[model samples]
Target chain A: MPDTVATGPGPAPSGTALRELTFGEAIREALAEEMRRDPRVVLLGEDVAEAGTPFKVVKGLVEEFGKDRVVDTPISEAGFTGLAVGAAMTGLRPIVDIMFGDFLALIMDQVVNQAAKIHYMSGGKWKVPMVIRATMGATRRSAAQHSQSLHAWPSHVPGLKVAIPSTPYDAKGLLKAAIRDDNPIVFFEDKISYAKVKGPVPDEDYVIPLGVADIKREGRDITLVATSSMVQVALGAAAMLEEIGINAEVVDPRTTWPLDEKTLIESVRKTSRCIVVDEGYYRYGITGEIASVIAEGAFYDLDGPVRRIGARHVPVPFSPPLEDATVPTERDLFTMARQMCNK
Target chain B: MATAPNPATTGVEAGTPLRMYRQMIAIRLFEERVNDLYTRALMPGLAHLYIGEEAVAVGICEALRADDYITSTHRGHGHCLAKGAAPHLMFAELLGKEAGYCKGKGGSMHIADPATGNLGANAIVGGGAALATGAAYASKVLGQGRVAVCFFGEGALGQGVLYESMNLAQLWKLPVIYACENNLYNEYTHYSETTAGDPVARPAAFGLPAETVDGQDVRAVHAAASRMVERARRGDGPGFLLLNTYRFRGHHVGDIAREYYRPKHEEQHWMAERDPVALHAAWLVSEGLADQAMLDRIEKEVAAEMDAAVEFAQNAPYPDPQRVDEDVYA
Candidate 1:
């Protein structure tokens, strides 16, 4: 049976907790806790050493765990990612950072073809227990080459567990859970949330199990489902809806692949309306997948057509104004939620 | 690094054994039948036959135990048979039958049976090297005195993933044996045209102990693989053995005749002069282990097995469409 507390919880107590930690700090804590608990656990990526991670999430990890466990590889995502897969197959649980989510393109063969299908192709004779961390979202105008919310790509590939954490609490718990998972997990951390989002995280090592949704705010008018940076925007929109007596429920599906659709359906059933917010481009995106599942599984329960708010179908721009326009915003979520509620 | 020794001198026992000859014959007959089946349109997907390169698989696999794992390339029927996959299942898999390993989901290029530790063949070039490294690492961790053998062609040496895997295997002293089957061609392109320099130097530059061996001699391959497997099992780190061999067929079944790619005489030279299985069989018979009658019997039995496999595959049912979503997780 599944752990009851994972679905019905105030907060897990036995796991390591970080109080008021930035998104980066929470990730660091998760890696530290997993490494400390399992001797087979290791960390590897370019600039993941004394220089810290490209986003500073691996700060002080090398100093604490020594250079052997905190490996800093050459600038080759395909090569190092394959090496991490090798390490994982050999009995080492590796947490690999790709530095930028956009760079995942360089190692698609390793991530999609090899790591994702190894266990099943091998008839369950082997399990690749590895965590791949990549920073997503267009922050600081990194533009097309550096900043991309590429979680949708990994989510499409079978045999991979995709996690996109939106807050310090989710970041820490999800990272810990991914490290301990028997499958290969791709954990995307939104660059915009690196230092901005903070929340209460317990000091003990605990796991926020995958495939479970967290209801950020419970209400009856509509359910706003979001991921990563969009979660915050949805919450902001929900707050705005309350004053207008809409009372939207916000759902954050911390992990995207083994999705907690049951929770999502239940919330949507009560509210009779749903708005999916995503940072990726709208056409054939993760939002489309979520909406399709809901339409297929709970179409009769819905009182209003499900609306999706995502980035416009355009390459992420460089200029601040254009970039801001490309990504979905609180205004977009608010307008969609209001439309759904009024309908 | 130690000086490179002659592979024949380095790893052979006093005399070639009858069992070794049987394995070589089995691989050759099985591959030839698979090629015939592919040509007859009985097998599904593409097939990369290992007709001319039988020595490398038979030699190396003979050095491994049934429990020791092997990761193969697309041209994997030889490796699968030599590693002890039942001939019937391998043929059935090529025919896309449920009786085959992977239940027909993995046809020609993706057959695997972990029961005998044959950890599937990958269609992507150079993809299985890192996986084999991981399997070896797992063996070490689980306290199993097992070694992992990864087989790829000369072309894979250029992939950065192989270099990365090689570095990790050496650095961590993982129990992996990298068998580079240098067949002198990647599809229609010759090695000289694609590779910048010698392939052996690449691994040597990465600090891995490497050697170039004559891939046509089964005795030589067995001896070298035995030493490398022993070194890895004892925790001495990874070894790279570059087997100098040739692939008689084009890259895959249904390939156009490549006389334009190479001189016709060179093709004849390799096909007639360097047939690994025939040479190994001759050695076994000359040394008084077996005769022509025994070789003929083995060939007949292997053919019978393949025929039965084809029958089973033709009659087997396809997987239900609903089960497509199954096995994606866990």
Candidate 2:
């Protein structure tokens, strides 16, 4: 492979100001650009203003936007989540951060019942244009409550559009589009990838529309579908599989709902074998969804059964070794992909 | 909009005792008609009658400007009628017809009319507090000088969001008033079984001014609400009113099995002596604001209006099934 062979998807950063940014910095830039674009856009969550949040994804936002716009809320998930929906209804583009993904259950009534159903239940009389950001993934040993990923919950909901960006470039582009989208959306940020993932993001403003998937690596032997932080795992597994003469195509369904089924089906069709990977637990999780959708829509193209690799069905443990055992590793994915290729 | 200079301060349009009496008559008759329709199966679903708590909505609403906002609870017909929602459209919503305020998609517990500043009646307990706070925030940011009134029950105190919204409301001094209609019971359980701490002092813990009023006495409730609404409009922070009242009817139309809950003597005590509608009517007569004939005429007119509303709801068409899923997203 050469630099002349075009290593990345889409056009090269179309501005002279292209630079590498950490995932958190890319998200902050996205929020700043959108807030500058629309005055109604405001950020509200616990510790958003004074502390820049626990992950510092929204660091320095309070200085750019005043304290009024960049708000710090009390630790009331259900309360403020409902308040965000209320603010969205009246005339505010509220971007609420849940701090940790597991705490979304505290606001499940407001999020799933109210925010997701308000537009439909009101017969189009109201639109809840808001974004809820939650930090997900299980590597930092935040323990069971903080580290677990819950993308599967939002994906099952009807009205909400879910997005899990795997890279800084996608994080910036997809977040801007989500902020502008009129529907209520749940945007999941991989805590494990926030600082570890970096890519060339353009300084110029742009948006990556929701419900579209990005091809991170092109291959022909077997199709690998991944999500969030697991996208990196799939790419790593692809490199490992290539040593045995297996070429694995990697597809990131950036947005969970309104999936780019066409790209996935085409990739699966070309490869005639498929494997899905997700940070969520294997049972009743996103991996099951992708595997089933491919089997249903592109069954004729499959050479064998479509497989999946995901976290085991158990609470994420406190100890390092037990937690490590709970999550699927790159080598685990390698075994599944190699089994798919019979290599 | 401040009607607090006097206990009987006249509202901008419908503030006099006579007009307020007429409004109360309309609400009482409207709820009776809705109860009748639900019994006959002409309308579907449970209608939380605004039977015993008329003064809470009427008195509080009389102090509001037309542009001011209100977030209502499940037992919200009185609030809607007091806020100027057309009874015909309200009946239409109950009947699941296209002519409803929410075009029949939102039924009794979820009726909302943004055009009239009725943010919507929430099915979930304490759900509307957050929305009302946000509406008040919008009023402040828009510089509209408008105020928001949130109508919740004593049961809402058990909800965590109530305290959350109150803290935020006082912290920013948003132009909003929290009106709690402590109707003695939450569905079947006594409110004492669910609530904790003193009701009036609850909001005060958040440093917001809160008071308890006689919800049966329209004049007292009106005076207290007027004072609160006036303070909110001046950006003086939010106020809370704990209005003690009782419901004469069952919680819903089908909830007639009351033996397991409060004693029959309690219902008789409220209905026999402290009926809000009857109390207000007696006051109107004692004050020489209306005679027996005048009160009789108002009831007849309201009854006729109720008949028309029922007829209109019956004649209105159901919404097309194709439109059911149209609004799930943008």
Candidate 3:
């Protein structure tokens, strides 16, 4: 297991007092600290300055950094995102808040074509050290337009780095590292987990390097490789598995691209059985990519086929029951793990 | 909209007009060399020549400072040269040599040099508008006091992002100039068929100070661009300059047959009467600025320079095959 704090409703590590912070608060703290540290870092999005976004994550950043750095833009996703790419190219390290992951469709040209390829296209003469922070996950009752886990889109591109944070600690540290990184990165926050999830966060500045996986709870029976919002589901399933004597190891890749393939392969090697979980589509999604990696790396070590669990291949519905059914739940994982292990 | 048909006789330094004349010739000779390379199948890809619209690029870019930023379109050789890029480097880039700008990654459509403040030529129509606007936004936020000029064909009027960028630039009073070169055609179709309503009204609706000038007259373009550049530099918002010109050649080098969209007489009419180079040279000789011998000597010098640049690019080495994976990330 990686040398890190124990997560998932666990007790604090010995001799270290960790402060409890909500996921939103952790994200806000990261932005605040980075902006204070680097004057070039600026935040721009709709209602980001005063309204602090609908989630109230950045409620008081404008009061501290003032309006120049914490700018509020019109509802022009392509325009501002394109501008942010250019701004990042020239001087400023812009953090473009894209509101929702579904809105990524609108700014695909800027993100995929412009921001991601600027460095390579210019023969590495230009650097787009920018972060596009957008929300993902489903079951929000906001319908398909507002909810999506589209981190796979940027991850598919070559130059972009994709970060998917699972908890408050990972959210703060990974976001800080995303801002400081030289390449353009897409940071996908679980909208559902912003207010619902809480975890221990250190008071001082820290950077959880991208591509490092955190094993939330270690076990030998099986490996539950998860990302973003699914990390919580995997942990919950791990708890349920413990009640039966099936010990499931929960591993959060944290970042989809620049993926911690070593940790994932090593976990699969130890467990011999694996299940990949993600919030993106089940068909041709992150689950398939990770499942293939496990199969390729630990082909001989595996006892059976590596299974994949993800959101159903459909638009997330508006109704509560239907929306709930669209996404993979902890119970679904627990049932799948039991069947796969023949428990 | 105002039009000055003739080159101005006053209010310009003696050497300024001569330099402008030389720059326009340089662009013309460069395009000639490009067309030659394309015809011989020596250049890998075709290029959109900046032949007839040299006056607009020369005039506007002459008004910009060395540090000011400019975003160009696919037909951007004139803009790049006017902004001080070396001819040999540009030819090398077009030929995909390792010594080119962008290290041969970006070809003719994307010659970018930070030293010259060229943000890169965009192959996508209207793609560079927001980028230039963003540079202006950065200039405003960082107090750089630099003005950014976005150069696009009139065809970009159809793109919504152009208007979006203009609205933002105006709202923030960002130092940007939207230079629309109305070359009268959007690929094969005439812009009038694709564009509805007046072009200047679009920017004017966004509260931008818009003006239309005679693109054939380099002095008029220079004068108008200078005023707008100064206005933007002094904290005034962006301005839209509509350059009413014509495309002397087809859209790209491969687009030779013009009977489909354009008539023979029309092309002949523009080339014979409204050629910006011929018009400027005639005015220069008539005003006693230079004789036929001096103009011929300028053309000779530019022709020789372009010849040497083309040869340099022809002999330059291609990038190593193993280096294909390089520069993928910073």
Please tell me which predicted candidate would have the highest TM-score against the true structure. Answer: 3
How high is the lDDT of residue A321 in model 1? 93
lDDT tens readout by residue for model 1, A70-171 = 888777688778767866865788888899999999889999998999777654556789999988898469787887888999999989999998878888
Model 3 per-residue lDDT tens digits across residues A54-122: 999999999999999999998999999999988887899999998999999999988887888878777
For candidate 3 chain A, the 10 contiguous residues with the lowest summed lDDT are A1-10
Q: Comparing to the true complex, what docking class would candidate 2 get?
A: medium
Error of 1 at A146 (Å): 2.4
Those runs of model 1 whose alpha carbons end farther than 4 Å from true positions after fitting are A1-19, A62-66, A203-205, A296-305, A336-343, B1-16, B65-67, B136-146, B170-175, B230-236, B256-264, B288-322
> Could you give the DockQ of candidate 1?
0.40
> Higher lDDT: candidate 1 or 2?
2
Best by lDDT: 3
**Candidate 2 positional error at B7, Å:** 27
For model 2, how does the per-residue alpha-carbon lDDT over A181-268 read when each residue is reduced to its tens digit? Answer: 9988999998867777767787688899898899899999999999988888888899999999999999999998879998898899
TM-score of each: 0.87, 0.94, 0.95
Worst ten in a row by lDDT for model 3 chain B: B1-10
Model 3 deviation from native, Cα RMSD in Å:
4.3
